[model samples]
Target: MKIHEICFSPTGGTKRVSSMLSRALTDETVEVDLTAREVDFGQVELSPEEVALIAVPSYSGRVPTVAAARLAAMHGNGARAVLLCVYGNRAYEDTLVELRDKASGAGFKVIAAVAAVAEHSIARQYAAGRPDAEDEAMLRSFAARIRRKIDDGGLDEPVIPGNRPYRKAAGAGIVPKATRACVKCGLCAAKCPVGAIDAKEPARVDKKRCISCMRCVAVCPHHARRVNRLLLALVGRMLKKACSQRKACELYL
Candidate 1:
């Protein structure tokens, strides 16, 4: 069986988690970057024998809208799917359920689900260095179980967590901006998943379209992209209680 790792990871946390799980899950694999702008997301086809590992980071307890759109547009053609939701130490409230629904709607047979923690995208102090050694072990174990189930021709539907009407998407108002250090290289605009940045003027951000996923900041060569420091600090402080304790990776098969 082949594996397709489809993910929308802006700051590398989700990509890291997906890659590790994909590695442990199957040998033959290809990555379908959800961030790519040129590809016709709906046209990517997968055979029934293929397994799609669909993952996205939780943005305020919901699927990132743009990512969800791309995923919903894809045609999975009865391929089995493993859904994953990665979050800051806070919570992955409705991300898994939303993803499962989208994958199933796109024609994949939903088989398993996972909720994993990684360093907070914005609130870095929480769950820092995670999907660390401990997470890796648990993910590998989950993969072993998944492999056995597949090997045994088990096609049971896995139950995932979340609500019907998902919580309103929050934490997206504060868009990052380029600093004086920005040399207008245009890389940020080129890499923006939603094409929210000004292509001709890289430093100017289109806030209406920006999802505050921090992809520009993560890819900026000059370290010039950032959001309001005070806002960031305030958010970090607010999350202190929910994120103070380390959360474990959860797998539902």
Candidate 2:
């Protein structure tokens, strides 16, 4: 049986956690990058004997819309899926349950689930430098348990936390844009997972298409793309209390 690491990470946090889990599971693993704008996940087929680790970052208590769309296009072909929802130290809310349902809907059988903490893609102050030593240990332990379960031919579905008909995504109305320092390098446009930015112009952004995943901000070499500082401050203040307390990784096997 093979392992597939399918990840949608806008700011690298989700990818980091996913990688740890995949590596711990086995040395032979193939990756499916959900953030690539040019790739279609539908073409990536999975066999019944394979297993997939579907990892996605939670956005406003739910899966990012663009990521969900990309995931829905995938063909699981009855492979077992281990669902993971990585959040920015706040709460995964319905992200895990939603992912479980989505993966199952796409033809994967859900075997286990996890909700992990990562540094906020926007608010760097919370859960900063995480998936640290402690987090790494947790991931390894969980991977060991998973390895045992699969070896025993256990296919029992895991019961994960979250609500169906998930919470409405009331996203923070903070869209980032290129500042005067922007050199019009077009890198953001070329790399945008949703193709929201115009490749030729690079300055203009299609707000309607943007999911506020912060990929552009994190990828900018010149530090040009940024959200409004005043808005970011307000967001920081709003999340400060909830994010101040450190949360531990939760696993459901």
Candidate 3:
């Protein structure tokens, strides 16, 4: 069956995780970039005979609002989907469940789900080099199991994680700030998914439009952009207990 891999990854963490899983599942994969600016969601179409491996990063415990909107515009064409939520070492919270619901609503059968960890989007120290060798090995094994289940026609229910009423969407603060090293190259402004940065002055961020995805921070050539260092340090300390170990990638097929 054809495999459709759809994802929204700004800094490439989510894309990396999704690519690993896609490679394990099938060599015949079609990719859809949900992060493209001026995306025409109506252009995307899936076929009933295909299987879709849909992945997205958890932006503050929820799907990126813009990505969700783009996903909603597509017709699944009866494809069965493997919903994946890739996150920083932090918790995925309601993202997986929300994705499941969205995929189902788009007329795709929910056959499996996964929560994979990648380096923190804002703070790189956490989960660095992840979907690393260990994670790749685990994903390969999970893909084999998924293939077996499909072969057996096993469409049993899978337990997806999340509460019935999802936690409220996280606040949209934590805007990235540029350091003295910035060259005013405007790369961040050009690459921002939401036009949050001022194109003429790369260092100037439009806080109201920023989603705190940290795309600018990750893409900066000079490593000039960063979230508030004090805030990140405090957050890191508070979450240290919860972030002690990287969790194994799970599959529900």
Candidate 4:
């Protein structure tokens, strides 16, 4: 069957997880990059003959607002879907359920789901060097199981996480700022999904437009980009227990 691999990855972690899952599933894959700056939601469409592997990063236990809206705009054409929520070692809380609802609403049949872990987006030290060989092997086995289910037409009731009324979206955190080490490079601005950064003056960031994906901080060559350290510290402390534990990557098929 045809495979459509859709993803929204601001800091690369989500994309890395999605790619591994897609590779395990099939070689014939079509990627739908929701992070593209010039996306036209109306242009994305799926056929019933295809199987959609819908993957997105868990942003504060929820899907990114823009990614959700874009996914909602697409017509799934009755395609069966494998919902995946990739998170930075922390909790995935409501992401899987929310994504399942969104995909189902778009006319896709929910056949399977996964909650995978990658390196933390904000704090690199947490779950560093993840989605490594071990994780890849696990995902390959999971894909094999899914393939068997699909071939046998044995998909059972979907088991997605989260309550009926999903949690509300979290408030935007402090926007990242450039430090003195910045060389006026415009990479961050050009790669920003929302055009939040000023290309001419890379230090200038539009707080309202920034999604706090930490893409700027991760991409900075000079390590000049930083968010409010105090806020990050607080977040790290709150999620320390969850982040500290090395959770296994999983698949529900």
Candidate 5:
């Protein structure tokens, strides 16, 4: 069966996890990048026969605004979807339930859900280098179970955890800035999901537009993009307690 791998990964962690699951599910796959600013998401339609592995990272215990908007615009057309929410060793909180609502609203049938952990976007130390070897094995195992359920043809939506009125989305306030080492290569500008960085200047960033996804920091060739040291440290300390424990990948079918 053909599968659509729809993802809104900013720093590549969510994409990495979803890609593994999709590849395990089927060889025939199509990629739908929710981060692509040029694409009109409303025009992207899916058939009922197809399966979609829709994945996104949990930002501030919620779905990123841009990802949610892009996803809501897609025409699911009653397509079956397996929702995946990747977190940074912290809680996903309302992310999965919110995704379920969005997918259902867009006409997708939710069959299964998975919550997994990846390296923290801002605090590199937490869940560092994850969707690691063990994560891959478990995710592939989950894929097998989901495939069996799909083949059986009797599917019931799993109970996704979260509240109807989701918690307020708190900002990280960790906008990345180009350091003196920046060479104006424009790579960061081109890769920014929100178009927050200026292409010509490369150093100037629109704080209002920036979602603090850290795409620019991750993509900069010169490794010049960085958040404020004091702020990063403060955030790191705040996250340390919740992120220090290793969280296991979970599957709900």
Candidate 6:
């Protein structure tokens, strides 16, 4: 069966985890990049015979608004969906449940769910080097189990965890700024998912438009874009205990 791999991974961790699962499930697949601004997600339609691997990073314990909106616009057409929520080893909180709701609203039949750990997007120290070798093996195992269920035609929705009213989304307070080392390449501006960075003046950021997803920082060739040092340090300290222990990936079938 054809697989539609829909993912919104700002710093690459979420995509890394999803890739392992998707590769194990099927060799033939189509990728839907939820981060691309040019793609009209409303035009993305899937047949009932197809399977959708919808993956997204947990931002402040919830799915990113842009990703959710884009996903909701798609026409799932009763496709079976396997939802995956990647987090920074802290906690996915309501990410998986929220994702499942969105996918179901788009007409996808929820079949399985996964909660996986990845390196923290902002504070790199947390869950560093994750979706690592261990994560890959575990994710592939999850895929194998999911594949079996699908092949057997058992399509009941798993008991996804989370509250009906998802946790309120936090604002974009950790906007990345370009340093003096910036060379005006405008790569960050072009790659920004929300067009927050000004293309003409690369250093100028429209904070209101930015979602603090860190796409600009991750894509900058010069590595000049950075969040405020004091703020980052504070956040690191806040997440230290929660992210210290190595969290195992979870599967719900």
Winning candidate number (TM-score): 6
Single out the weakest 10-residue window by summed lDDT for candidate 4.
152-161
Per-model CA lDDT versus the true structure: 0.90, 0.90, 0.85, 0.85, 0.92, 0.92
lDDT of 6 by residue, 109-202 (tens): 9999999998899999999899799888898889889999999998899998898799999998998888998999989888888888889898
Candidate 6 — which residues are off by over 4 angstroms? Answer: none
lDDT of 3 at 17: 91
lDDT of 4 by residue, 152-221 (tens): 8764647776876778888666688899999987888888888899999998888787888888888888
Backbone clash numbers for all candidates listed: 0, 0, 0, 0, 0, 0
Question: Which candidate model has the greater lDDT, 2 or 5?
Answer: 5
Expressed as tens digits, the lDDT of each residue in 1-253 for candidate 3 is: 5688989998999999999988988889888888777778778888777788889998878998878888888898788888899988889999999998888888788888989999887667788888799999998889898877766776665899897688898877789899999999998887888898988887777888888888898889999998788998987887777776877787776
Candidate 5 versus the native: TM-score? 0.98
For candidate 2, lDDT tens digit of each residue in 98-209? 8988898888988999889999998889999998989999999999999888878789998888898899987536679889999889989888888889888778888878
Worst lDDT run of 10 residues, candidate 5, spans 169-178
Lowest-sum lDDT 10-residue window in model 1: 168-177
Per-residue lDDT of model 5, residues 1-253, tens digit only: 8899999998999999998899889999999999889899999899988889999999988999999999999999989999999999989999999999999999899999999999999999999889899999999999999999988874699999999899999874778988999999899999889899899998888888899999998888889999999999998999989999999999999
